[model samples]
Target: MGGNLSAQDEPASKRVAAALRGRIEKGELAAGSKLPSEREIASEYEIARTTASAAIRLLEQEGLVLRQHGRGNFVRETSPLIRLGGDRYSRKYRGGPTPFRRECERAGLTPRVEVLAAEQARPPIEIAQRLGVDSFTESVLQRSNLYFADDEPVQVVNTYIPWAVAEGTPLVERKQTGKDGIYGRLEDCGHIMTTIREEVTARMPDHREREMLALPGGTPVLQVIHTSIDQNQSPFEVTRFVLRADRNGLLYQLAVD
Candidate 1:
């Protein structure tokens, strides 16, 4: 039978996409399963190859499919979700695995982090404002890292600490920051970590981010601007995290008074 469509009123492209979308949602196609080629879909649907292509494009724009450069389109992978929450930063885990590692381990995935850069530098205007730095020319220690889960890139983290707070500290000399990650070192310098604030938003990824995350064209990145407050009610650290929307999730449980 040729073009055996369930509905004949809609455009040919949408009908084909709807049929395929049904299979995807029903688990008939399954995650990571390659979709039939446009030509194959056209043959099966008895529609023009261009119409078949348009159908596949619709699925891609909706994030239901991913097109590898050389390979074909496949359902997006949905397993091993790395979740972030307040518990990830618990002080009890300090002097050991970082938050990223702990979350990955909890999800039963291997974790890795690469320090892309660590140095003392002038802060951006927004970062300066967040840190309450008066002089933009004053230096702040910056640590840039790329986090991975099971060898797949997941997020980018850039941390900034005021020079007045970071100067003459272990944070200036070592990437590891000695123990307990940066919090332990900051506490050693007398900035007790007592509270945190995270502002989250979503936006389209730039070219560099797209390449770094190996994201498909229609994907967007989740931006989280994190601020750490100390016992003195001072914001000592500001971190900008760019996470892939597909591989990571957010969970927050707050107590309301």
Candidate 2:
């Protein structure tokens, strides 16, 4: 066929890439199968050899294919494992602006948190259970915040701590002067949170999150339910965080029993 392209007149490289992508997606080019040479593809598609090479390179970069030095390229047999909702997710930096700041930095994204409500308040039902307290317990301080990235509100988090542990710390005492990181501040008070449990799920954003995050209808939000325990194995904090679905990629690692 002639190079009539499309109304948008996409470049030859993209066109070739698209054609090859279609075949791979449709399973015509099965995973692990070697692709035809660039010269063969160019001849078949009536395009320049450079365009065919570009297509293969694009696929390699996208992790869809592997190019062996002497053996041309083969479709990737397996995709990269994107872990999600795992326990004890480790990061390079221990205490920082946020537990996830290091990961965001690695991905070339800026992460920030806006302290919304850091005052003392009764813990909600969800927070009580994880904190190992009675549902009606009013002896707690609630910390609610809106987390952002690159000016986008990505997560809304609500954390709770029993008053005894929070009363003497800046985490709850000086709500006006927001602490850098709640966990860090807790550690400063000689209560190091050595264990954390997190439960993650994806669901459509609720009205409050939709309005605050300016999320459009049908956009899903990842909900992370977490519980932090101090060195003595006592529950210290309970947190519920809602993260924008499109803004994050969760990693999970599992070990077979």
Candidate 3:
């Protein structure tokens, strides 16, 4: 407890929270170790019991600690790390297991996909633009999926395909895309993808995203918008991927020809 105290201008709860967070980080309080009880913290820190409780609450909100019913708070477990690399999109990889399934297998975790919605709907203006369709004149097949690694939600994906291409395909069906995934199906439909473009950005999660991803307070999410184009220079699919910042690392490899 003899570490640097918070700035004088900081609130009492913040000061207490900082000290505990330092301890946790420094391994003074290891994972699964119980934190001081509110009464004990109040007595030791010479602060009101409510202030001590607030400090603990702050830690809980940060995902650094978890409170058990009738029991005190304990340090929470760290999440598994996942690397999303460019090689995952290779035709060879697609011919075998989906990238997500392969990654989870490598990490010894179960991978599961829950189809939230699969239907034909008018695309959002941005999606329509990416798909080379007029929002007013065309409808797109939209498929939303929630991906889990060992029961922990890690990503949300929304895929949009022009109705002309997906109207009679499995992309509009509420089921797994099988071993080859959507790209393989697209190829089967005579739309062989020759290029893919992805735009990535980061921001704080919205309320629904926070709940769906079970993110800690102050955690940021990564958004990736992907467009697949066929050899004919026509866009075939547009997908929006929402990933947990703390759990995934995105990697892109460029061949040095």
Candidate 4:
């Protein structure tokens, strides 16, 4: 927050935050570097302590800084790697149905689902193929949205389940259970998902998505297709996840012989 009084720029507090952010971005401040105290900033900038404090709050909200109770604030490290993919429905984190929420929480991220629309509909061709069912068969159509840090829409997932399997189950019944995972809820309803296979591809964004994701013209989306199966070896669900690559980093480990 320390700067000259005649700092001919936007607002004084914004100028201060911008200067600090620039320093951090340029590695001058670096991650984990403690910011100057409020009094020091006020003295250096010839501004009031309140201005210095306000600058910190703004940076924190922008995800540019982290404030620890007694440790003061520092630039937040860039978004963490998102590790996904694992054994399906093994009760790895929770014994009940949904463990995905637990996994996300353990990674220090908030997860929520907004039901866009859910009802019985014939499976789309691609989804029908993945689910190993006839395209004309009625399936449970569900759309759930996902939000990430800064309230950005990182992923939009559309899922399909056969009504015969998900009907009357928590998977079909939308709930406000913030902590429950859909997989867990499905298990609770006796679906007992046992495995999943996934496919991934990347492509340029179409006009609709560019607007929905608020992306510039050139950014591409990472498309993931997943088919999950039950213990009976029957395909249970098909999910298509469209993720914003800039905000999400997919992690995978490779083993070579």
Q: Write down the lDDT of every candidate, Cα atoms only.
A: 0.86, 0.73, 0.86, 0.68
Among the numbered candidates, top TM-score falls to: 1
Q: Which stretches of candidate 4 lie over 4 Å from their true place?
A: 1-81, 87-90, 95-109, 174-179, 254-257
The number of clashing residue pairs in each candidate reads 1, 5, 0, 4
Q: lDDT at 76 for candidate 3? A: 75
Report the Cα lDDT for residue 13, model 1. 92
TM-score winner between 1 and 3, please give it: 1
For residues 1-257, what per-residue lDDT tens digits would candidate 1 score against the true structure? 56665578689999999999999999999999999998999999999999998999998988899888789899987764555567777877777887877888888999887888878888888888889986458568888888889999999889999988888887876466656788888888898888998999999899889988888868788899999999889999999999988887888887788
| TM-score-sorted candidate list, best first | 1, 3, 2, 4
TM-score of each: 0.91, 0.61, 0.86, 0.60
Model 3 lDDT per residue over 142-164, tens place = 99999999899999899999889
lDDT of prediction 2: 0.73
Candidate 3 weakest ten by summed lDDT = 77-86
Reference-based TM-score, model 1: 0.91
